[model samples]
Target chain A: MNLSKKSKVFIYILLTAAAIYFLAPFAYMFFSTFKSEAEAIAYPPKFFPSQWHPENFIKAWTSQPFGTYLWNSILVTVLTTAGQVISCSLVAYGFARYEFKGKNILFMILLSTMMIPWDVTMIPQYMEFNLFGWINTLKPLIVPAWFGSAYYIFLMRQFLMGVPKDFEEAARIDGANAFQIYWKIFMPILKPSLILVGVLNMITVWNDYLGPLIFLQDRSKYTLALGLASFKGVHSTQIVPMLCITVVMIIPPIIIFIIAQKYIVEGTSGSIK
Target chain B: MNRKKFFRTATPYFFILPWVIGFLVFTIGPLIFSLIMSFFDWPLTADPKFIGLGNYIEMFTEDDQFRKSLVISLKYAAIFVPLNMIIALFLAMLITQPVRGVKVYRTIFYIPAVISGVAVSIIWGWILNSDYGILNYLLSLLGIEGPRWLVDPAWALMAVILASAFGVGTMMLIFYTDIKNISIDIYEAASLDGASVSKQFFSITLPMITPTILFNLITSIISSFQQVTLVMLLTGGGPLNSTYFYGLYTYNNAFKHHKMGYASANAWVMFIIILLLTALVFRSSSAWVFYETEAKNSGAKKKRKGGKEA
Candidate 1:
């Protein structure tokens, strides 16, 4: 795979161009957040504000109940991630380690569930949640993950299946019950995959808009994504504050992605193969 | 049955109970109920009345928006699926090259994907603003006029496409990983045979990555059809209903317009279309998608047949 200097230069040029395409919008938005409303939208748009107004972030935060929204986002993300990791692992371990009757059928059903578009079941889900009086609460968003999702379960099952059968036999011979072996032995071994599931779930729940948009009504119940979107609806002309909130909303997920880049890559490749 | 034997038999189900319960409560029950609701004339406030096939019939025969939204979604998928895949695969190949500081470039590309659709739409909105947008300003400096990206019906869909394509890095990473895992020896051997780099890519890398291509294709099709958030936030179905995506149409019907039964019908239509598309692609995949297991199995059969002949 050795390359000539010319080819290397060409590659760098192409890479730099693509990087700009991906990054230029964020860079523009980040800098524009500091600009005054008029300056931000001035013709021949400025790339850097003449006067850095870090106060825009503060203004945006207080303009809405963004602190409340941030807390709700964190609550949903943390709970869902914890729930998905634990529940998916248990379900995946069952499918991977046990030879129960109807296991193949049940597992097939789980896989097929991934293909069912949320649009189909969402109306009835809304109705059901309403009947339970769970609408306008975080329960609709957070409670379901406790039962496990098909994708995470499948992912965990893939990781677990790669473990040798003999890995668990030694523990069983020592009279460790199935639950004990799962909690004591497999949980530790599945740490990376658990982290993978947690990270994936965190990013999704943190940034989800439609789930909150549908079930929750009050601004108090709004997650960061829902809150940011609502902000846009209210103040369409206020670009600076909107951009500020957008920047604030994106920070946590970007930070999480940067920290967990390795697991994310490995998890994606794992799921495919 | 004895207690011990009963417990042993139930162990697996106990372990998997959470998902089974969830499937019944959250997935299957709602699925069945939504199907039933599709058959009725249910509204948000009023009591439901049985009107079997009424909603479906109205959708096909009467609802122009229904047809328009469907066409819009199809047109989007047609343009987007292939374009995004190419960009993703191309970027993937670029990043996988043996170059310095490629990691930084990869992170830069993927950072946009990690950002929420909400933020992405806002950023693009400001950048594509007709008067004050940075993009239009930049184009003006080049002695050109940028179309009102979000306003003009002619360009609204394209604007949506441009904004959505920012997240192509996820698919790029998928292709990158697949390409990275390929044995370097294959390319080296191809080089020994005097195959050009392009020739090696076509004969080796391309064929080797078909499985990943198929995976990306199917997933992207599913996702592109479900592309509600970007359009919902970015265009709000726009100046001329030009960008009223089917997902948005269905969401509006159910949540905004409060036609629960009609929306349920809309959703079922989308589901069937997706199922058919998936089935068609899967059937066609045998012609192009090269599976490692299939290759190995055929090789094994050949060796066995040769042994028998000997």
Candidate 2:
């Protein structure tokens, strides 16, 4: 749809306005992080800090041993993302390239699981983990990703299938076996899918309030999401400066998303298409 | 050569080993055991008591809070999914034009979608605070007194829903992409045939994107049913169980109330309900979901007994 010059200008103006609208809260978050308590809540909310409270960031860091929580969150997110990449890529490769026994049936079972809401499975899984002594630890959170999520596997498989089997097929004919085909041929082709699934699941695990909330009973071991919730729960009434911490808590995932934003438009979904 | 052949044969399973183990440990093992737990009166600290169907029976017969939680979740899903999808679709349409810096708009909108659900909940908890929050301050501009959104029984669920609606960025981005990916020839043909912009959209764009719409709808419904953290952090099932989502209710029981068996039973019911709804969607999808490949398979995947071609 070709646009007239006037139309293009109007569209640009509209886009700029929309961008500001979308960016307002984030802008507010960053600037307000340095605002004093009264200044943070000042009517016609102050857009700039009258006095930069660098101490607030330090205060935010120490408000509740969030430093430890940060490490736990990072550890869990990295492990979970790494586990998902390995698990999802493996399963995705199997489903995408192979015509093995129970191939279709197994794939169907996997897809069916995608629709099963965690709400339905939460209590049951909790009970299972409780018996296994997996609670008060990150096992329930980190371990699940090691078992590939159906969605990530589906995405990975779709991407893998699209990677012209010729690469792996040639590798196979070149006296490179299947394991060699996967590692030397397919795994490299699967980088985009890997990054996509990793970032997608990382955002999910990083900001997951529910997983850690359910499993992490130890306060010292809480992930950032759960820690923030506990912070809010503890300081429900006097939550002015906690906003600073909240800003910090939400920034990492958003930054990761922004960095990967350009790649999200890579033509079409994986394995399915 | 034998080693090569052996590795060739074993490669798929080897790749899938971690996944298989994870699936059994995290998903299937827990899945089957939870079903078994639903029958027994088991607490975390005590020995299990076999009370077959007692928990399910109690849910239907005696528990009003359980009933209320179900209703609240239904209402929440009923409203939230449609609202988010509608707004998302609308915004996607608004941005689907060939404009400069439109990518920036797309990125901006997707920011909240990328933000963790937990972070969004907390930030919104501050924004919607009854006492000196942004929402009420805006409301006060019109001389209107806003109720304690998270505290008021009438508004608590709606408050959480409203908070969630802000994250429509991903859906919008998805829809925008789907809409943009509409074959250019189709639009050119439509315009050549005297179809107006709106007509082209309703005819070509809407029909082609039905698959994405259906996908979004099913996922949104499933996501809403699994409501936990936002309500947990924001409302905590609220002033009078107004926002007592079933997911949160079941969690409260299993962890807080220590009724592990009871919670398991509740979860099983929730699972059954979701399974039924998913079955219904799969059933109904034939009539509505306009998968471009559907014409190739006359019966579509759902009708096939063993496995569909999808």
Candidate 3:
């Protein structure tokens, strides 16, 4: 619909107001990270920090065994991402390129699992982990991710299915084994999708609080999310550093989000079929 | 054994081996274990004594928290799903037009979607702070008294719900893309037919976007029921147990209360509700969801193509 000049001005104003309304919390949280506790809890809720104390972040970071938790989180995310990308690629290739027995039924089962919440399995899964004596370890958090997650597998499978059959046909004519064709031919073409999934998994694992909350029993074994959660619990009323820690926790994901979002929308959106 | 055939067959299994094991051990294994555990008097410390339907009976009859959680969860799902889908769709429609600096608005809308639930809960907790919060400051300006948000039993869950509605970024992004996909020619055609902008939106846009609406509704229902973290953080089920949601309750039973068998039963009941609800949505899609391609399809592949487009 066309609009008059006044209408356009009004639209612009409304949008700017909405932007600030939605974005104010982020700014508030960031500024709160720099203020003293008294100022943070002061009346009228100051829009800016009274002091520019970047050291609040350092205090928050050093407040916990955040270093170890950060390490654990990095390790877990890397392993899970590597596992999912490699394993899902192989499985997706199988679904896409090769035909086999019980394939459709298995795929349907895989898709159906997507709707199932992790809570349903909490008790039994906990029981099993208890049996394995893997409590407080990173094993439960990371190991299962190596298995092809159903959604990632489906996404990769869709991409693989789009690859031209002629490439494989030509590879066979050149005496290249299926392994060689999959590795040399399909894997490279699947790089962007793989990177996207891997990065997605990293963000997911990084942001996950429940997994660590459930599995890890000790403070030293915590991830960034779990550690920050505990830190928040301990220092809830302490305004500045807690907010600083909160900001620290999300910065990586936010930064990664800005970078990876371009690939996610375009790369995935392009493959409509 | 030829290497080519061996590689083809073996490689897929290798790729899926992790999932297969996880599915059996983690997914399917726990599923069966949970079922079995539901019938037993299990504690974390020792072997569960077989108690045959006792846990299930206790959940519905004796355990007040279990029943309360079920009600709260259902209420939460009922409210959360509609708000998320409606608000997100509205945001999508507003910013979907070909306007300058739309990307900035889109990015502003999308940022909160990617904000982790943990971060959001903490941020909202601070924002909803009773005395010094920005919310209260805004309310005081309007000469309205702001209730103590998280502390008050009556408003605690409602507060959490409102907090979530502010950041319906994921659904907003999904709907934005969905709206963008609608051909501009449809709008042109409707305009030529003397349809106003609102009329075209209701007729052309709403009907076209139902599939996404339906998808969001079902997914949000499932997620709302599963939203444990916010409650776990904000109220920890609260001062008077008014805001105790099902997920937090379930986690409490399994972890804190040492009622593994009981928790399993609760989870199973929740699963049944979700399954039945989702099945109902899929079941009724034919009646209300206007599948343009499905109306014309004489073959299955065309329908598959159509499904992927939405």
Best by lDDT: 1
Model 3 Cα displacement at B117 (Å)? 1.9
DockQ of each: 0.88, 0.59, 0.58
Which 10-residue window in model 1 chain A sums to the lowest lDDT? A264-273
Residues A1-273, candidate 3, lDDT per residue (tens digit)? Answer: 565787678767777887887899999888887887888899999889778777777887887788898899889988988888887888788788877767788789888898887778877887788789888899988778777788888888888777777768978899987678889989999987898788778888988889899999888898888887888888877867767777877888778878887766654443332
TM-score of chain A of each: 0.99, 0.93, 0.93
User: Local distance difference test, per candidate?
Assistant: 0.93, 0.80, 0.82
Q: Please write out the lDDT profile of model 1 over residues B161-260, one tens digit for every residue.
A: 9998999989999998999999999888889899998998899989999999999999999999999999999999987999999999999999988999
Per-model TM-score on C-alpha atoms: 0.99, 0.92, 0.94
Q: For candidate 2, give the docking quality class from DockQ.
A: medium
Error of 2 at B151 (Å): 2.7
Against the true structure, candidate 1 reaches a TM-score of 0.99
Candidate 2: lDDT of B224?
Answer: 88
Docking class of 1: high
RMSD of each: 1.0, 4.4, 4.0
DockQ winner, 1 or 3: 1
